[model samples]
Target: MITPLKAVLVGCGSMSRAWTAAAKDIPYLELTGFVDVVEDAARQRAAEYGSPTAVVSADLENTLDRTRPDIVFDCTVPEAHMPVTLTALHYGCHVLGEKPMADSLENARRMVAAASEAGRLYAVIQNRRYDPNIRRLKAFLDSGEIGPITTVHSDFFIGAHFGGFRDRMEHVLLLDMAIHTFDAARLLTGADPVSVYCKEWNPPGSWYEHGASAVAVFEMTGGIVYTYRGSWCAEGLPTTWESEWRFIGRQGSARWPGDERMQAQVVTESGGFLSTVRDAIIPPLPPGAKTGGHAGIIREFVQCIQAGTQPETICSDNIKSLAMVFAAVESAETGLPVSVSV
Candidate 1:
């Protein structure tokens, strides 16, 4: 019989619903605790997940002590991640937490150091890397049909009017949301950010308190240039949340309209002023590939701990993605290009 790994979920916010739901489907996992600053939130999440008797508490350390969970699922907000992750690692438990890694690079580094000291796994849920289209796109890019990638571009425009903390926060787009896209850029290009120049402004008629719109230019490893133009105040004909992506290479280019289907075109001959073009086939996913998004990342976190391996989004690696976010924010603040580091 399989001995299930007991897991405690920290932070019972709206995002916690997805984590709890995914846990129920993993046979190797057993939900044993739920925690939030507000005990009622924990109780509500526990009952909703059919674990009414689970240890529901307002105190994370106390809950961890009581349950003795083998794993800690951190669904906490950015600022809370540092303490939650440190506490979990201090308990000798593996951790899987939500994206953006931490509120700042210093805190993220502290979390990484704590995990290393504990000798346990700590991975982030950069779930965007697990999408079907992205997997297929990655395969296609590596096939060399595009020759050498020269440039990448993405556009994100959506009027997100959440009248809460986000509307009141500074660097709203870069801090609260742009990290997802930055992380995706890393996954797709298999490159790290070298430096960045960014301009951020709260557009006229914007609903947010600060920095709702921005444009950034990034120099990636391999001399690839990535440009991002985004606005949370854009209302008409908004791009998909995944954002429309275009990757250009010497021989060809491919586009993903932030959707399942992708299209590509390559140069066939050089007779005309512009080289003759032919459609390039975007390949399909490799057989048995798993693109399970949130569930996929959660499963990876558990599987890696059991196998004594590191998951792809482990803190040491994911901090690069987070660095891009901070670098862009710094560039926006200083009005100068800043080196990207973690």
Candidate 2:
């Protein structure tokens, strides 16, 4: 039998729980241990998960040398993803990192090149792309049920009570959250962004040190126009994050406003109809799937490791979406349209 890939997690934050649970369910992945800069946090997390092997990794080089796992998961802060990822690749291990790819496009490119030189699979944890609602939307678009998609719009509006890493961050909205919107836009439209212009604003009397709202217009490949509006501190929204997406095609359109408590619809040239919104449908699970994000992504990653193929939507694929966010940030900074080069 083919041996399961050995996996090591480099951070023990809130997302670690999901990662731990997902790893447990993937037979082809062996969870070696958890590592954190904070000794207590790492030990506590390991105890909570009933894992006896977790360790505090003050020196990553030493830890990796000892563990020699086949796959390294960099669930650390955005800024730290680069060093951890590059080190993992240098040590001849495949890497899967969380979103935003890296703190900057420059570092993201470097990481990509390192992965290429190492000849190992390098992927991003863009779990949102695996969302079932998104899958359903993609299916509808691909079926040409929505003909010649002309316009796309999405929102990541939320009134999050800031804490942890997000509270003390800079460029709050674009850096911290826009990757999901940007990636989803690219995925939903099946196109690349060519040019972008954006306007950003920090809400008056808001607690955030950075801009909280941004609206961007993107010129996508195939002449599709994409618009995204997002805010980290919109008030009085019943949900924590209210995501709305609409695809207006030449012959039809589709919209997913939220889950069951809300509603989604499709309008074709023939007629308009409301999609069946099951009440218990949860956000992370998306819409069409029997299972959801963490589980789905882990399954795919395991398959990729065994098949020796990069996941279709890997970090390299996500680079274009990251470029979109940077383009918007550039637009917001220079007050001019910015073209996406990647």
Candidate 3:
């Protein structure tokens, strides 16, 4: 019989709610306790989720001693991820942290090393890979139906006034939101980027000092070129997050027009080379197939911990996506392209 894994959550905010809900339903998972700096907040979250309200202490040692959970989930902000991860790993507990892993590349490197030394599973919440649409696309690319892939272009765009926390930041767009797009691009290509060139620009009436819209091009080791365009402050945009892709292969190409319910198109030629174009909408995931970002990510982390294997998408690879994001920032700052090695 499989034993239910105990979990303690830190940073009981909006994101934690999904984790809490998942814990209640998964037979092999249990939400043992909840902690946060704010007592009432922790108590309220625990009440909603039917978990214990441990004293929300700043010291992780104290929390671990009290909760003694097999897993510690760090749903904290970008800056808080490293300390929490290191502390949990030091105590011999598995950790699943929110994305970007850490605010800086140096911290991300240290976290990866720590996990390796401790022999514990450590991973980030990169939930996009499990999306039904993305999974279908991955299978298509792997099948070589369109021949050898040479280039990929993707876009993630949305317009919203984030007044709570996202807007009040120095590097607003890239650091705060573009990680998803960059990570998704890496997953799609199945290749690590060897170098990158990027540009960022803020409109005259933009609220953030840094550019809200940015573009980045990556050169992969196998000569695969990737181009990514993203924005978070485009006014009157009709989508929450519009995901589109253009994949070029030696024989044909595939395009994702950003509708989850519709089939994407794949075109391949049959003359000298097999040239064919067919409307193929990647099927959406079933209702219970893990749609919520944090929910899906946490479930995978638990599975990894129980199975004694690193999550296929670990921090080591995620650092590459982070590299792409920071490279864009660097390029934007210097008004020149920056090459990155991952």
Candidate 4:
């Protein structure tokens, strides 16, 4: 019988539940401990998901020393991601962390360096990449059905009223939410950003303390342009969490209306003065374990650890996604386009 890898979960916040659920389904991973700054939170999570003897601690170092887990699931806040990840790496533990990599690009780069020095796997979970519709969209784009994509557009709107740190954060929309959409755009286009011009402002009657709505234009590799417009304080008719997408290509256009359904329009004839257009039926999505979102990322993390391979969201690659977030924020603040540094 194969021995399961011992794992510890840090941060017993709302997101931890998803990680706990995914951990339960992976046969090779065993949850052995829970740690949080608040001991009660750790104890509560342990009671809910861990074994009777599972270790719980208010201090991370103490918990790491006691449990000595093979893997650490870091569900901590963005600002805490670096410290938690670096500490786990120093202790010879692989890490599967929540998104945004770290609070800032410099910190993210440092975490990547630490992971490299430690020679342990450190992967960030950009769960949106696992959505079936997104996978289909990418496959369709790559299959040349739409030809070479020239531009892409995405719109996200939501009226979130979370009464917490997010409402007061300075770059609330970009930092807390837009990262997912930005990361998804990269996955869909198979391109990294080169530069960005952005504008951000708070609409009248907005609940957020700082900028809560913005529009950004990004120049990506292969001369592709991606534009994003989003608002966290939208009051009515909110867009789906996945956002609506439109991909413009040389021969056709593909659109995702923020759900599983996708549509395309391709030019059938162009030799004459008038071009004929026909609806392009999207191919069926590729099959897998039918596991997706957070579960899919968790499975990949575990599999990569076992196989001694780098996950798709390894810090080195994920940092580029994070850079887009930071660059857009900078452009918004400075009122000028900024070059993206990967």
- Per-candidate Cα lDDT values, in order, are 0.90, 0.76, 0.75, 0.90
Q: Which ten residues in a row have the lowest lDDT in candidate 3?
A: 281-290
Q: lDDT (0-100) at residue 183 of candidate 4?
A: 94
Please give the ranking of all candidate structures by TM-score, highest first, separated by commas: 1, 4, 3, 2
Clashing pairs in 2: 132-286, 132-287, 133-286, 133-287
Error of 1 at 217 (Å): 0.4
Report the number of backbone clashes for model 3. 13
Candidate 4 residue 128 Cα shift, in angstroms, is: 1.0
TM-score of 2: 0.88
lDDT of 1: 0.90
Lowest summed-lDDT stretch of 10 residues in model 2?
277-286
TM-scores for all candidates?
0.97, 0.88, 0.89, 0.97
Q: Which regions of candidate 2 deviate over 4 angstroms? A: 53-56, 238-242, 260-291
Higher-TM-score candidate of 2 and 3: 3
- Per residue, candidate 4 scores C-alpha lDDT tens digits across 1-342 of 444799999999989998888888988888888999988988888888857999988888888899899999999888899999999999999998998799999999999999899999999999888888788778888889878999999999999999888889998999988999999999889999999999999999999999899999999999999999999999999998999999999998999987888899999999888678899978888666223889998888888777777888888898999999999999999999999997
lDDT of 3: 0.75
Q: Mind giving the per-residue lDDT tens digits that candidate 1 earns over 1-342?
A: 445699999999999899998899997888899999989999999998897669999999999889999999999888899999999998989999998789999999999989888888889998888888888888888888988888999999999888989889999998877898998888888889999999999988898989999999999999999999998999899898888999999999999988887999999997788898899987679986658999998987887777777898998999999999999999999999999988
- Residues 225-273 of candidate 3 have per-residue lDDT tens digits of 9987877777765443536788888756787655453334566446656
- Residue 255, candidate 4: Cα error in Å is 0.9
* Predicted candidate 1, C-alpha RMSD: 1.2
